[model samples]
Target chain A: MKYLDEYRDPELARRLLSRIEEIAPGDRVIRLMEICGTHTVAIFRSGLRHLLPSTIRLISGPGCPVCVTANEDIDRAIWLAKQPGVIVTTFGDLVRVPGSTSSLNVERSNGADVRIVYATIDALQIARATPDRQVVFVGIGFETTAPTVAAAVKQAAAEGLVNFSVLPVHKLLPPAMGALLEEGNLQLNGFLCPGHVSTVIGASAYEDVVNRYGISCVVAGFEPLDLLHGIYLLVECVVKGTPQVLNQYRRAVSRDGNAAARRLMDEVFEPADSTWRGLGPIPLSGLRFRNSWRRFDAGERFSMPVIQVREDPACRCGDVLRGLMEPPQCTLFRKVCNPQNPKGPCMVSGEGTCGAYYRYHTESL
Target chain B: MKQRTVQLDQGSGGRATHELVKGLFVEAFRNEFLLEMNDSALVQLNGGRIAMSTDSYVVDPVIFPGGNIGSLAVHGTVNDLAMRGARPLYLTAGFILEEGLSLETLEQVVRAMGEAARESGVLIVAGDTKVVPRGKADKLFINTAGVGVVPPGIHVAGQNARPGDAVLINGTIGDHGMAVLCKREGLAFENEIRSDSAPLHDLVRQMLEVCPRIHVLRDPTRGGVATTLNEIAQQSSVGIRLLEEALPIGEDVAGACELLGLDPLYVANEGKLLACVPADEAEELLQVMRRHPLGAKSRRIGEVTVEEPGRVFLKTRIGGHRLVDMLRGEQLPRIC
Candidate 1:
């Protein structure tokens, strides 16, 4: 707790809070979007909203990879899970997300071989152990995780693990930000960029967003002080009319990011047009297997009939992801949709906007 | 549609576990004792009050850093009875061993259990064992039931908590949980986390000696301090406010929880207990608890309040407040 406790100093946090209050413009409503799922959870967990001034509103973005993953992708993963002798392994967040007709959790309960793994290497180890059966790792995350998966794929190829494959649903963060800006649905003064993702992709990645939309982007860590300081920097930018990409989490992130990780990702994958759950068909936002690593692609290795996917029309997860509406505004927020029995991805994923709200903000309700 | 079968979440000791207990088990065996729903059941026997509790240990790795399933079995049941302000006297253990289990391993586990029972001043009066096929059961599983004598004129229950009462914890939280998780997942940190799995009957006895009017004594095991506090709040029809800065947590445990994207409040602890006592006697009780080794690091973490009945809130370090709700399903690691 050496490094962590220092950031959570009560005296320091008090000073930062007062500073933010003093500079925040009181005449107009300022909307700041935190573009990382982890930040959303941290903000709620720290009760920062209650402490912040009334004029500044924090909106959740489409940074939760599980929430942004389209239903068709989940259907395809469930279809792969149902195939005989195929073992499906994925992160725990994706297991509870609902698909068109079924979810991985329900499928697992009904006798499907779905396992929750913390990392892709665990899935690879399973494949090496059970060589007779197929082990398909459902890879889903942002740049913070894609490089690790890419390393796992390279390791599998080197070891010639024929049973190992990956259903790569990995997404890029910067392009998704562009797509959100293009939609022009919500007016956002600035953006709180993801910290871990910035460590891999760097602070320079948001330069395009700033150049295009004139929105300030502050890369921040997940600690309470980091978030408060990040918001202060964004508020400062808004007050000064300076739209620049700032790095408040410089302790972990760098300007150019991790070069070796970017190289590994470039070697294993290529950017492709992919469909997001709410923001559909963002160009070059999804990662696919490069020509050399095509054999590890589960989509190419397995042949299955296309399954039609459907979404509950009543679930307003789309608007929640786009920052167009708050989670409590949704009709099904705490009614039929809840953590125990989630009606949408936003309610299922722990980092989802609605899920975070239900966990932290329900006291007021 | 496929038929619903028992899933892992039902055994997670969270909301799902509560549902299964209330919707099925408790409903089938409805009675005054079951209705109480405290950690242990208090029954009258020969004009004396007795506390009885039972628990099963199915930990994946039969052995862990601080204790094994055998010792854990004893401590778990003994602590359950202690929560009722009873002096644990006798225990019964049942084991289901896998066919492939080695004789040496079984002896080691049994020896540990004997030592733990002796240390806690309890007797393993009865035990039974059976073997199953390798695929049918894990390496080992243990079920322990205990009966203890409740001292006369001592009444402590969850619902007895009153507003303006002070809440105290015995020691650090999340040690047992993170220890088992790190061992099971092979997550090696710079320093290894050891489980705080120990019997708390002695501490409970000393506490009751001084503060006989102690309102509530409950172990924060599965679903952790947050969930246990929520249950107490609902039962007592009061609000509990925890100070984020005052809650004791080990550095190693905090680091592990941060890495896994888990809250320490919701993590499990075996040797930790939450006590609610009158505000006036809290300082004296704290001094007595600190004299015991098990409660050396004990601190007053929160206080009972009249507002927001059936709710538990944590006052953040930055002058903000958030509700600490009960644990839902299992705390899964984040995708980041």
Candidate 2:
């Protein structure tokens, strides 16, 4: 409450709004991308988008882990859930994500033993309780969540729990940013980086993007005021022609991040070229269990019949993820790819760009 | 060691059944009406109209931080009767237990129910128990039916809301739902959040005494304040406009909602109530309500309007407006 209450103060928010309004209208349109799913929701929930100047456009990036998860990985997880004696556990968002043919939620209704877990440690508890059965955890998230999965694997290895394993689709942040920079279709003025992920990877992680790509980057918290302040800072950077990496959420994030979490991640997992749904395979963006920890890898433990499946061909989630198109711009956004019957992963999760846009901007679409 | 779980034979109307009905039920609820042990509770009333309501509670993880399913069942039924401007008097409980449930858990639930009934100044008159084999039922399910007497010259209904009515709530939103969710999901925060699961009948009585012209009295339970407001709006055929800044939500609850991607407006509450009254009488009623224990944090949240008949709107904190629609289903936590 201490940190949260102050950040949400209405009075402070009003002052910041006035400041943002004053800093804007230099007659130059600015395109800023908020590359975090949390920011996307905050922008909508607080009605920050309406408060900002129309000239300043905020784009949703490929930040939602579920939205960016490759189709083959989701299909594999579904197949694992349907296997005999295998109990698949995952976060709640992944339940509704459409795979090649069926989703995990459909598999669950079809009598597969699939459970939603809030954390990976719960999967270990299930495996420990049911010694005769196999517990496979679907590990997904960015650097913010990868450490916890790493810790769970290390704990499993130490306890020698042969029945517990992870089908980790964890991704890194910086490499994906690099890939987005490489695709130079949209003209972007700056970036509002992720807050929680920054606490783990640190503000220094964005230095490479700022220095090499010459883009202004600011790590922001997920409050209305935090977002307003972040946008104001980005606008100022653009107006001043100063491209630098800044830390706006200094209360939680530091320059170096959590050193111990980084150590744990480095010990249990190694970098690998993994396929992102929209971004293709970004080099060293995904985390894979090291050879010593291969026994705890669900993909290695169970033999999955290779299911070559593609996402809905009509879904422009790839374009949406790259900020090339808004969700409503897609032909299937409201008609075919709704939250109830999501045709793609972007519309399945709440943090997904399309889902957030559909929910918060109900009047527009 | 003795068998820790309840057996199917326990509900067979045999010796085990008698022990449970007497040793657990009778001992916990030591009242003369329950001691009668009849098929129906013979409650003597002074010839007046009585309000009766029934509810069933099947909350997962039956035992939570603030209360269990037993207390929740009693509170839910009592609140339902109270919404009709009635004074709750008696309650009946029927429990369906899973065979593998531990006797200790049953005792704990019964004790919590007894405590809640006593606190609400009501008596448990009659009860029933049944058990099924393993996998047939969850740990426990409770059903409660209540009877209360409506005070003379008092009327409250959802359709009573007029254009100039004021919408008021007892306290903060999303505490009960988020508390249960945190406990269920094994989420540990800096401060341990307990459910605000308290009875509001006494508060309602004080409010009615001050302003007998109260139009509507409903608890924001399952579908939360937003759904309840929408229901009231449609029933009354009047629009309701709520100020986003006027809503009372705790800092932790707000933080948790932000983390889980849930709207506090749609999250459930167990102990809070929404009352609509004429604009002039709202201040006097709120004063009386605040004097009561349960209504200290009560505030006027919105006002009924005639503009967009049968609709609800929220003025955002940043001066934007958005329509509030009925929640179609549960607000599941985001997967990421």
Candidate 3:
């Protein structure tokens, strides 16, 4: 708890809060978006949202993997889980996410072999253990998790894991971020970049974003003080009309990021146009297996009949993901779409905007 | 298209557990003897008040750092009876053994159970055993039933917590759960985390002697302190506000939880108890609790509130507040 406890120090937090207050826009409304599911969770978990001045509004972006995962991919994963002699593995968050027809959890209860794994390597291990069954790992998340999945694919290829394959739904942060700025739906002052993702892609990854959009971008740690300090840096930048990518989480993040991780990711995967649930299709935002690694790609390895993907008619998860609409503004938020029976991806994951709002927001919906 | 079936969350002893208990079990087993649901059944036998409780242990890797399933079984039942303000007197153990289990392991488990019972001054009055086919059962499973005598003028229940009452914990949170998880999953750390599993009847006895007016006594077992507090909140129809800085959590346990993306508040604890007492008597109760070995690290964590009835909140390390809802499902190690 050495490194963690210091970041959570209440004294430092108060100091940072006061600093942020000084730089905050007094009479004008400022909107800052945190483009990471982790940041959304940390903000809510520490009740940091409540401490901020009312002039600054924080919005959750399309950062949650489960939230942004396209419906077709989810439906495909469910289909794979149902196929005979196939074992579907995914993170716990994705298990509860509703697909076009059924969730992985529902399939599991009806006797599908769907396992929840903490790491991509666990799926590889299961493949190694079971030679007769095809093990499909549902790869999700941003740069922070992409490298690990890439490493697993490389390991599987090296080990000649015939039973192992990955259904790659991995996404990049920069492209979606560019899309968000171009949409002009939500007027944003700055951004708090994801800490763990920044550690992989590096703080410099956002430099292009800053240069193009002329917005304050600060990479922040997930702790409350780290976030508050990051907000202070952003507010200071906005007040001074200076847009620069600053790394507030100096301990873990760097300019170049983990170079070896990038190399590994580059070797196993390639950027391709893929669909997002709310954002639709964004060019070069999705990751796919390299041609050499296609044998280990679940999408290529399986030749199954296509199922027509259907989106919920009333769910406004698209606008919510873009920070254009609050979760409560959506008619299905707490009425039809809830954590127990999520009609949309935003209500599925705990870090999703709707789920966080449903949980931490004390006011009645 | 149809209603979802009962899942594992229903068995986690949180809100879902309450649902399963009230929505199904209580309705099916509707009787005066089973309605109290105060850890143990408070019944009158031959004009004397007695408490009875039973629990089964299916912890994976039946053996752990501090103790094994054997000791846990004994400690769990004894503590349950004690929670009802009873002096634990006797216990009965039943064992289901997998055919392939080694006698050496079984001997070790039985020895630990015997030692725990002896230390707690609870006699194992009767026992039963059965051997199952290899695949039908785990290596070993233990079920223990206990009976204790309740003294006059002692009535403790979860529904007894009141607004303005103090909430105190026995010791550090999540130790037993972490110990078992580490051992089961083969996780290693610089400092080895051990289970805090122990008989708490003696500690409860010491507390009752000093303050018999204790409102609620609950072992924050399966769903940890958050779920336990939420249950107390709902049952008592009061609010509880916990101070994050005041909660006693072990350094190693906190580190492990951080690494695993788990919240210590939601992690399970086997030997810890939450005591709700009058605000004025809280200071005196702490002194008595601190003297007991199991309660040496005891501290006041929170106070019952009337602001938000049937809710729990944590005054976070920062000057912010968040709701501590009931455990919904298996607390999956989060990525965020």
Best by lDDT: 1
What ranking emerges by TM-score with the best candidate at the front? Answer: 3, 1, 2
Give the DockQ ranking, best first. Answer: 1, 3, 2
lDDT of 1 at B164: 98
Top candidate (DockQ): 1
Fnat of all models, as shown: 0.62, 0.21, 0.57
Write down the lDDT of every candidate, Cα atoms only. 0.91, 0.84, 0.88
Those runs of model 3 whose alpha carbons end farther than 4 Å from true positions after fitting are A329-337, B1-6, B332-336
| lDDT of candidate 1 at residue A328, scale 0 to 100 | 90
All DockQ scores: 0.55, 0.15, 0.50
Which residue window of length 10 is worst by lDDT in model 1 chain A?
A356-365
Per-residue lDDT tens digits for candidate 1, residues A1-365, read 78988888888989999999999988998899999888999998788898899999999999999999999999999999999999999999898898888999889887899999989999999999999999999999999889999999999989999999999998999999989988887888999999989999999999999999999999999888999999999999999999999999999999999999999999999999998998888999999999999999999899767878788899999889999989999999899899988888999888999999888886462
The collision pairs in model 3 are none
Query: Per-residue lDDT of A247-335 in model 3, one digit per residue for the tens?
Result: 99999999999999999999999999989888899999999988888888888789857889988778898888999898888887778
DockQ of 2: 0.15
Task: Give the alpha carbon lDDT tens digit for every residue of A245-361 in model 2.
Answer: 889999899999999999999999999999999899999999999998888888878866778886778988989999999998889987867765688888888789988876667
